[model samples]
Target: MKVKDKVVIVTGAGSGIGNAIAKHFAYHGAKVIVSDINLEKAKKVSEEIVTNFGESLPIKADVANYEEVKNLIQHAVTAYGQLDVLVNNAGVGPKQMAKTAEYTLEDWDDVIAVNQTGVFYGMQLALQQMTQQGFGNIVNIASLAGLKASLNNISYTASKFAVVGMTKSAALEYAKTGIRINAVCPGYTESALLDQLLATRPDMDARLKRIIPMQRYGEASEIAEAVVWLASDSTKFITGQTITLDGGTSL
Candidate 1:
């Protein structure tokens, strides 16, 4: 599909994988909505987009909150007059990873609240708008944990699995409406900012590296390229599918 002029909204666009996806979409000529709880970071991302000659809207939004998601959609529509793609990528991992027997309710609550419910709200709102417009693409970013059983982090795994399931269900429901839905599952992405947190727990981080067949972690940009294709018309025939970008680890 041609990339120019499409209006795309990317949640959690301020940093990490989300930031890469937003910038990639913008660089490819999509008018992007760079939404996040961090308005300052969003503005910086938007300005970077502008400096690179792409149209962007930097909006403050909390994907975990339903009202904020609704407002975000409103903001995007107000700025662009229409929306073509919605990338529901906002999510938070479990606060503390522990054996299920030792996991706290607070950790479970936080994971389900932000990762699972946030995607639902964004999907609901985006689908409503897309139905009215009669043409759109929705891409949710899931994790390899969605497919593989995760230990010591039950909540995050459960939420991601739900996202994958929801993506398929939504795609089926809207297949006849000219709306396409899909999910992308990425594995072992190396985030310097996030890895700083891993430094606090060396053992867990080491374990993560060992499971992947690719000893090295994947780059954020590699995942970004996959996301953009799913958002584009080139994958027009594909729907309700989960594309895994796991560096052959799943094999």
Candidate 2:
């Protein structure tokens, strides 16, 4: 897969999967915009990219805020001349696990704000720029919960499912205009998020591994590779598709 010279923006790139995607894209010669709510973390990732791979710019933007998202896109275009790809990867899980009926309104709203509405904001703004350019790509970071029910995680499941739906709808609407949209659904990936989860529920580690066919968590780099391929020219014919990287866990 080749992404040389492409200008790409990745949200939530301060850590975890988003961080890996930013570095991987830069490694492949893409000029990357590492956007995160935390300015310092984003700067650290951008500096590391510049040191080890290629060009990168760090920007602070909370994906949940429409205005911030708009500015993020504008800044990327101003710096790079054009936008080639946008990865809506910023997301948050419930702070406390609860069933649908027991789920708090606050948790639900918080998760939806950053996970669902945030994705829409990024997609909408990126679409405007890509429409003008007449060619672009988008890779949304969805989750296994999007494809199937995740016990005690209604908010996260709902948000990710929306991401999958939005990716498909937007891909179809823009397919004729040279913009391709797609999503990657990962299951139990090893990241800060998972670490937090495991910190509270130490027993979950064995339970989760027992259920997954591979008996191990997916790596952030593996998910990044899939996103890169989707954004690359090799998948020109593919659009509105959700590629699952769950080690057969869905099966």
Candidate 3:
């Protein structure tokens, strides 16, 4: 019940880590706003939350677009009296693997639009509400790739690095305002994105296990747990930090 009665907005809550985080917050007694580009998927997650006797609202939003991002925050406020937590978890990867010099401009733009710019929109809009209320927490879902560069993942790495940097800068800016901003950098996790990445590098799964001390991929729920803790009052003094949940892969 760490987040009891709080109002939370989770972008990209249709599936994967986003979906798990949305449900986790609801189970902890928060009124969750489940947002995704796909309305159907958003509805399904929200319905499941309600079935568990948790409060939830489903909304369709593409975080890459500033207008849609604005509407998302507005809708959440309309549904709940105030906003307490925001998890910017929506992201995209480049279509193909390529060295930095050979990466396509189109892929770079697409990835940056969703992964970097989308996060910017969410943070700015959420800050407006939280600053007025004088309390809030934000958890941006970065990747271990943000901390350490990966082979042939130029776009994703760059965008996640931006997220990490932004988290620290923003956190410092609001440290005395009763607002905290932090990031979670997960390693290889079981998700549709991982599946897609594995498809490109057929031997990646085994390679990853050998490198990671845990010898296994992380679960979406595990990452969700860390997110909830950061969002809770338990970490009131913690800000401008990136929690790496990569099973020692980054080590």
Best by lDDT: 2
lDDT of each candidate versus the true structure: 0.89, 0.95, 0.94
Give stretches of model 1 more than 4 Å off: 192-197, 203-206
- Clash totals in order: 1, 0, 0
Error at 48, model 1, angstroms: 0.5
Residue 199 displacement in candidate 1 (angstroms): 3.0
What would you estimate as the lDDT of candidate 1? Answer: 0.89
**Tens digit of per-residue lDDT, candidate 2, span 9-52:** 99999999999999999999999999999999999999999999
TM-score for each candidate, following the candidate numbering: 0.95, 0.98, 0.98
Worst 10 residues of 1 by lDDT: 191-200
Residues 1-251, model 1: lDDT tens digits: 36789999999999999999999998889999999889999999999999996799899998888899999999888888888999988888766778999999998998898889999999999999999999999999998889998778899899999999999999999999999999999887876434743765769677766877787788999989999999898998999999998877787
Better of 1 and 3 by lDDT: 3
Spell out the clash pairs found in candidate 1: 1-234
> Roughly what TM-score does model 2 have, to 2 decimal places?
0.98
Clashes of 2: 0
Residue 22 in model 3: lDDT: 96
